[model samples]
Target chain A: MTAIAQQRKPGAEAATTRTRGASSGAAGGGRYATYLLPAAILFIVVIAVPLALNVYTSFTNWTGVGPRQWAGLANYRQLVHDSEFWASMWHSLALVAAMAVIPTVIGLLVAAALFDVIAKRFGPRLASVLRACIYLPQVLPIIVAAIVWGWILDPQYGALNVGLRDAGLGFLAHDLLGDPHTALLTVMAVLVWFQLGYPVVIFMAALQRTDPALTEAAEIDGATWGQRLRLVIVPQIRPEIYVVLLTCTVASLRAFGWIYALTSGGPGEATQVPSYYSYQSFFTNLDVGYGSAIATVMTVIIVAVSVVFLWAQRRHAL
Target chain B: MSAVLTRRRPARGKLARHGLAKHRGPAAWLVLAALAVLTAAVLFPFALIALNAFKPPAQYSAHGPLSFPDGFSTGGVSTFWQTADFGRALWNSVLISGCVCVLAVLLSILNAYALGIGRVKGRTWILGAFLVANFLPQEGLVYPLYDMAKAAGLYDTPLAVIIIFTVIQGAFGTYLLSSVLSTFPPELLEAARMDGAGRARILWRVVVPVSMPTIGVLLVFFFIWTWNEFFLPLVFLVSNSNQTVPVALGTLQGQHIMNPLTTSGAALLGVFPTIIFFLIFQRTLTRGVTVGAVK
Candidate 1:
């Protein structure tokens, strides 16, 4: 009986091995195609098909309902002289710059203090609560945030002006969204406020992972807090910093929903980002070919910015 | 007790050597205060929105921005519910987001499993493709998608929104899950194989159970993202009944801008589900964002 059991065990093992080998071989050869098929089909049908069509449509002068006349590079050429497009792109850059600088600097400091100083007492609980509160805006649909902000910044009977008058600071209260001068700034402020929590959380998380012993050693060697921070903590989380910068840049460039909801790219196209401009060209103007050109330019800009940022990250790593 | 004393002595010695103990005192408080202020800055706007929701439309504009509503009223809430297609929009949102969450999670799991565990060629390229696709702005493809959806007779349908969202979302979903899967120890997978489990059985019995937390996190994230999506739905669903909450809210805002009462009421109604969802998944969402941070 013992001999028979031993033989049965080996036989079962061999069978399993054979099956595993066969299956793994098959999976190695064609499993990606099988597993990837659903996503691929969906991407092709939905994303790729549209992307291809967009490229084709960009070359042609096609309204939403008409036969296409090949415009070749006219759409692209027109975009060069399209002052509105250039202005919107400039506005987008300003927004990205504003978002990156303020949030990153504040977030880093807050994260450092949270981790290094306040970590001993109410750190974990406070971190969680603060995180939730900060991420609250992320969950609110952009329209609600924009509209509520609109009311708060309303020139007439707006909350901001009302409070400002009461405090004898009424001079600072402009019709923020209505004035072309302040419209971009107001929109950027709202964007920054909405996005502040995410970076804070990200920074906090990255800060926690920073090695305490390194900071302690630097301290023991008489390095000041600021010096230690510059040398040790910043270098350690460079990758995270890069990620935050890239994400913030992308987000600011794609600043559509709030701009749409708040100003509708108005106060005379002052707050018009490329995204809103593209949407206007496509749906409002019903100029498919021109819209496609605008969108393609937007895509190229995003891709270029991302590539540059990534390259900078790699350069920093080296 | 001995270990605690030893640790304390060293920390005290270090502080004394640096003469930094006094400086640390106010610095810590300063840090705390700054964090508190930042937190308040973020929370106050949402508070304004919440406060306004409970007030009468006239009173909301009449009162100080920070003032409490004159009286809490379900009048606006009830009116929002009855007059608008809020209910149907909410149902459509729930259905579409739920379907997207399920489809994305399932498809991502298979792709992640194969890429993370199975010996597959071109895995790096596949991942790179997904990353590039994810980073491509949605506007780049919107017109083409609109044209294609129209050609296939899918324009103005919920399915059109679902398919577009699923594909766009899946790219990122796959990337996140694949990273999570790569962290799963290979030893356990090998052990499961040695224990006579087949690939399907291993996935079901071991991989799924082990990766539950990640799966949960992805579900909530995907659901929230899909639920909050506006532009795609706005472009695709032209029919009033097919309008999701965000699109409906946008339309409502345009139509009722002159009527602050209905507009504020609708805005309040539109944001309710999202707030409720956040509260429900607060724990998971927090953990999900901070997961790779510490470890």
Candidate 2:
């Protein structure tokens, strides 16, 4: 049976080659091969090679120096017992929750308000200016944003505390970054502020694509504003919702720079996300094998979540 | 009869419009007010930075919070250049960012074409791989790549920065460009083929020309990401001479522990190029991200 299947594949290949040749006339398959070479080289050298090396390193006892020895499942087993790794994983998940849910909710409200309320009164120029202002943080370097926020959130001499005292809201003014309990929340707030613009922009674009005629029709039918929104707007921008969710999820998982710049996983590992944990293992601890294992797991989680998202998207399309 | 009919019609129209217009009244103003409040919240820190950047060091230190600058001077700017290697750092940033943009754009265009137009087998798999690769955060591979760069003798060189930037950046570029490429009209490519054009000819003539807007978007996005990259350069580029602006600014902050004014000066200088670039290409940059998002 296997031999028969192989024989049948050869006949299919011959037919395909004949058709392909006839279609191309005289240029042959070489042109396509040539066109694909540069891309193939780039993919291999930059992407494929590094990825393969990483996977290999994950299975070894390499300390980023000296000879790498194959250790198979040991690294994976160790990761299962690593409390810091688990803590970091939870921290990362918490960050993702904050990053995904808050910005999305706020962005939806803002976008909905912009379309239903602001669009009529505000000129387009003003609307554009508002958008630019919101997106400024996103365009600025993350380090810069982190630094600016650091100054604002500084404990003693910071502007935020100064203003709070001036307004007699001193109780609200604590050491936001320096405190272990508040560090993660403060970082989350900064993340939400910086990322709010992304969802706003996407939601606005999606909202604009929604048919105003349908909305008008709904309005004319004596539907309340809430009913019109539920019946007309949300359904139209569903794909943008998925896109925002996926992008935010990934962004949250990859949180590093701001954490590095502001907290450095300080106050006793309070803000240590998985990415930072991975960095610590490799750089600070000189434990490459363990770090690679953590990284491999993260890669798997990211890929798995992304696959689920794309599947959902496909299901929605169907 | 005509006058009576006109008066009744106008009154009915006004009565009918009143409800919709009334619904739009207070709630809309409330949104504007809320937005004004949010804008103020967001703008306060940025305002502080700008205000401090202009003030003299003594005034900045001595003045009360939110106080106006005593006087404006270019002393900070001159001091930044003199005290720090601001010139070299700025040059290094521009060079690295420019090269990364060119390399990432070129690779992405080719890869996007292959995935989009070439009818390649496993195109979806390739795309999936790239997406997964993108999610592998920078810290994960930094050490390994650093070791590899050292082994290959590219460490502490601009080549090291360029290579690392191009490699990591290509992931997003591929994602953005492929999405853009997928939107190109298939009929146009079919027409090109029907005219006896080869794949290369079709790509160069039809696919590229039609995809310029997306390409422009990718260039700006890639440039921004490359310019803003910190971790890879921090780990890979060991020498001070090879330090990019962000790293240099970080170094200055660390070294100049006492003088908050000097640190601010350095930070201002470091951010100047990006501000200028943003001002100049603000329209394209805004449109690019929006286009990427919308699509």
Candidate 3:
């Protein structure tokens, strides 16, 4: 800006190093619309048209390449009666419990413990080191983690089973992932391991940024650690708590990489999720219309969830 | 306990040094011990990967997974790498993720300039549309995108994946940057504009430089997210030549070519590059997570 101002190319408004004219061009008045045209065009080309086509395709019957025939909610009616769809829906809710609700609860306690007790009594270095160890897995690609977990939970010659038998708890060992009874439970456990670090990192950072005086004040006022947590720390970080829950829930709701690598929807669809289910239909079954319907329904749920969270956030914080 | 403490002043810092941390002896040790156990539990899988990555298949079968390796071996890693053609996969990942990051950041900056700084008419609706559009999972767009990419003759190229992710990532970036820029000090824009600078000049010379920190965070996120992407790349990059690291590793799993040693080997192959990025950008990544948690 300064360089341009100094060129003085026979135009007006030379650079004046003064504090005047501050308010004139400060609130830029809408000549910026041309700048947005490129992004808007790209967005429409890439996402918007496809999104609309997806919704449209849901109401038609067509394979990947063919003339379309209108099915008009017939796919949706099929969705309602589909047992596997319901099971996948139910499994998605269970994942929300594992990845969002439970993690948030555990993360809050772990974060507070690390912040208040660990950092205070030990040092910031030790606390951050522990935090990093927990956070290390999160930075790895999800497919990698899923692959490693699949190996660990393998039915034969796997570590968990091998270790269990060695400890004379052989009865406790089973085919954790290959068995339908245990597949979803095993998958959910892996997700919890993968998901726990996010809330811990976010919540801990939120705690660090907030005024510590509040927690100290509660502590100095004869409040026990538990009471101080309830009265001071948790309430202080409510906005962060909300943010973590919303993002985690949204991520869990549409989680794909881990499931795709591990179960691929399963030993009898035990671990099927909406994302994987839709993919299977699209490519495996060649039922493009039904797949689009599943995806559209998923979009509706995610948008609804996001809107509710954002509205509540606006009311609470904004 | 002191009048100074109740005033919410610096005296609290003094008391904190000598206060709670000075007490709690056995309890503190117990807490430390528990945290150690928790860290070990969290790291159990990675530990398993490291221990098993070097074991030969014959020894792995003979001794069982729980046994210590006889010695180091690269047989598994080499075999998995050869089978997967990991060199090409790495190159493909680097190209795709890097292009997506650069393009997406520019798109984000431009979109944010209009909505946040220009305060364009109907900006709120535009922003909402972007949010909804991006949040619509890749599943919703996967089939159509596949068809479109095929129609455009981009079915098996890195360019197609690069272009698609740019828009998807850019939409979310626009939403985030708009909020950050809304509070951008208007005085800077005012001074630059008063100098007869055009919008383009001011954006590059002033707005972008000033907002570089947030932009850096956005860049880091875009690279990692694009690199980690699976479902879209799995569908679009059907040929082995264009496959990214995760795609190559993931698609090879059920091909009946894997054994226990190679499973650990494959996991390591997939995770190595990301581990380097995580270490290099450790602090920034942690900081970025909090920034991204905005309402």
Sliding window of 10 residues with minimal summed lDDT for model 1 chain A: A24-33
- Model 3, residue pairs in steric clash: none
Instruction: Give the range of the ten consecutive residues with the poorest summed lDDT in model 3 chain A.
Output: A14-23
Tens-digit per-residue lDDT, B193-270, candidate 2: 889997778888899899888888788888888888777887776677888877766555445352445545555665
Q: Give the lDDT of residue A145 in candidate 3.
A: 87
Tens digits of per-residue lDDT, candidate 2, A112-204, equal 777666765665566666766776677777776776677677776667787787788989889988898988888988888888878887888
**Residue pairs in clash, model 2:** none
Lowest summed lDDT window (length 10), candidate 1 chain B: B255-264
- For lDDT, the strongest prediction is 3
Question: Candidates 2 and 3: which is better by TM-score?
Answer: 3
Ordering by DockQ = 3, 1, 2
Better candidate number, 1 or 3, judged by lDDT: 3
lDDT by residue (A232-265, candidate 1, tens digit) is 8998988888888887878777777787788888
Docking class of 3: medium
- Give the winner by lDDT: 1 or 2: 1
> So what's the TM-score on candidate 1?
0.88
Q: What are the lDDT scores of the predictions, listed in order?
A: 0.77, 0.75, 0.86
In candidate 3, what are the lDDT values of residues B189-289, reduced to their tens digit?
A: 77887899888898899989999999999999999999998888988998899999999998888575788888888988888898899999999999899
TM-score of chain B of each: 0.84, 0.86, 0.94
TM-score of each: 0.88, 0.87, 0.93
